[model samples]
Target: MVTVNLGMLHYVIDHVYGAFMHRTKISPPFFSRGWGGSKLELLERLINQLFPDVEGQIWPPNLIQPMWKTVWESKNACLREGVFRTPCDEQLLNALPPESHYARVAFLTPKFVSPQNMACVVHLAGTGDHTFERRLRLGGPLLKENIATMVLESPFYGQRRPVLQRGAKLLCVSDLLLLGRATIEEARSLLHWLDSEAGFGKMGVCGLSMGQYILLLLLHF
Candidate 1:
């Protein structure tokens, strides 16, 4: 098991940190939420943005499942928000509404202030039983700040609950790991999509707990 300490370090320095320094490559002039008092009207502005809202609704074989009802998703041309991990089959992508642009925008939304021409910040949630509405509620302040219009997303624990039957059964470590991998896999999909479909800009991800882990994976990718 990955220790919490090193794992968090891997998340911050590699992923959350330096979102702007890298965005400098594209000479991006915009900024997301500023870290402190740094102010810029265009700090968190969305340009050529796309929001792809998908659903991760797992109807397990068992009629009675423990996992949450659904996992919400949000991806945009500029910023995507959700936990989209499992590999996408042709059917899945095709099912999604067609996109007008080939590449979408992305953002980090760090508490920093710059202009609007910089890269983007992407925010994903960690373990929680949050519904789409609830997630949006939590994201209200940031969104209203118009801090780089986040693509609010969902993770396994976010809205999709695990098999309460099995998870509650208190299974072995392997079983728990199996469950965890599926959740992480869902998170992986989001990063993969950003890397492949989003423009070739400096991308950064931020979250706590599971969010942190997913951010780490994004950096490694």
Candidate 2:
């Protein structure tokens, strides 16, 4: 009899993925452009300024007011796809790629629930997640429990991916910082919209891998 260890299989798969991601001709390692001059400095300054505010009890004021429009919906209206502007402030907008200016989302809910009685969770993207499909599927099962899901399309991903960028590997370290900053701002604004505009009773956030870190940052404000 032969015994197979699943743990070893998992490591094998991970090794294969790592090789494809880092050693392939088509796939570029992250931060391929190295640390940029002005953008890197700007990111450092912003981080220093924001670090102190994270400890404060008061949440930061919402700056983005996204006007959402339904792009697609199931025939029964139980699920829908929507999009809106990323709600990036002027300073952040200037630093982002033109293609990443808008944000996309997928909203899932049960048909009979009212917004006031339901809970909604905003799902952030992981390192390589470029679409709402995976997150939406993960949240779909909760519809029966009256919990809705909103999957956000991170900047530098999905329809927002920059033309020059390849896959999920960011071109520069500053781009990673920018992506994180933009995602946090957008998620916070979306939460505000869910509470004040959409009138959801309870709100929360969830993510996977890299997204988990972003979720933690969001909790600070």
Candidate 3:
């Protein structure tokens, strides 16, 4: 006969409970909101796309034409607000709606005074973001220091978010990835544009929350 001592009894109890028990059920766990089979398949595809072969040197994106559009002009600091746009990868574009205002960076820079060395910051925004609505206080000291600050309209942000979508809500999984791809590319495009622009003495990128997160990914690609 199998001998079950106190320690063995405890082990058996743990095994049985572990299979069908939660230590705490106060809040739903990660991925607890089960995505259906179709979404799961998309999740799989997303995984594959994200996890590319970990071999070979990372290649830079090809030259893309940047379309600049002025949205706001700040008299406080001679801020000339403009949008920086670059054509996204054709494949990525296919995923987005035709009218989708994707891959654009809203910027603020000094107009009258041209700095011999343009020190720029690629500032980013958080949720519920509107034009110049980011938490970061763009004007004042930085402008005084002659540091030009620009903000990239993140995926599903400002003009980039589809008009039909209405409000900023959690986008579908595919849309999320689509946003991510566009975002990384947009950051790359911005950097490329800065590099091409003449009189680019020094450039810096800064952000909060989502912005901060992308910087990590930006350097990797």
TM-score, structure 3 vs. true: 0.68
lDDT of 1 at 72: 31
The digit string of per-residue lDDT tens for model 1 on 1-221 reads 85578877888877754685576654322222122124433222211011122233332211211112223333411223332223433433332223200112223332333324334345555554243343344444563343442333432232333343221222232222333333333344444444455432444455667556755644433
Model 1 earns a TM-score of 0.34
For residues 104-135, write the lDDT of model 3, one tens digit per residue: 55555666666465577777655556456443
* Backbone clashes (count) for model 1: 46
Error of 1 at 93 (Å): 17
Each prediction's number of clashing residue pairs: 46, 0, 0
- Rank the candidate models, highest TM-score first: 2, 3, 1
Top candidate when judged by TM-score against the true structure: 2
| Candidate 2 structure quality by residue, lDDT tens digits, 1-221 | 99999999999999998888676756777888887455667667866643447655344446445555665566434666666777766877888899988887778876766899889999999988998889988887887688999999999998899998988988987777788878988898888888878889899999999899998887776
RMSD of each: 21.3, 2.9, 12.1
Instruction: Assess every candidate by TM-score.
Output: 0.34, 0.86, 0.68
The segments of candidate 2 whose C-alpha lies over 4 angstroms from its true place after superposition are 1-4, 20-26, 38-43, 49-52, 55-60, 63-77
Candidate 1 minimal-lDDT segment of 10 residues? 43-52
Count of backbone collisions within predicted model 2: 0
Q: Which stretches of candidate 1 lie over 4 Å from their true place?
A: 1-85, 88-119, 132-159, 162-172, 183-185, 195-200, 217-221
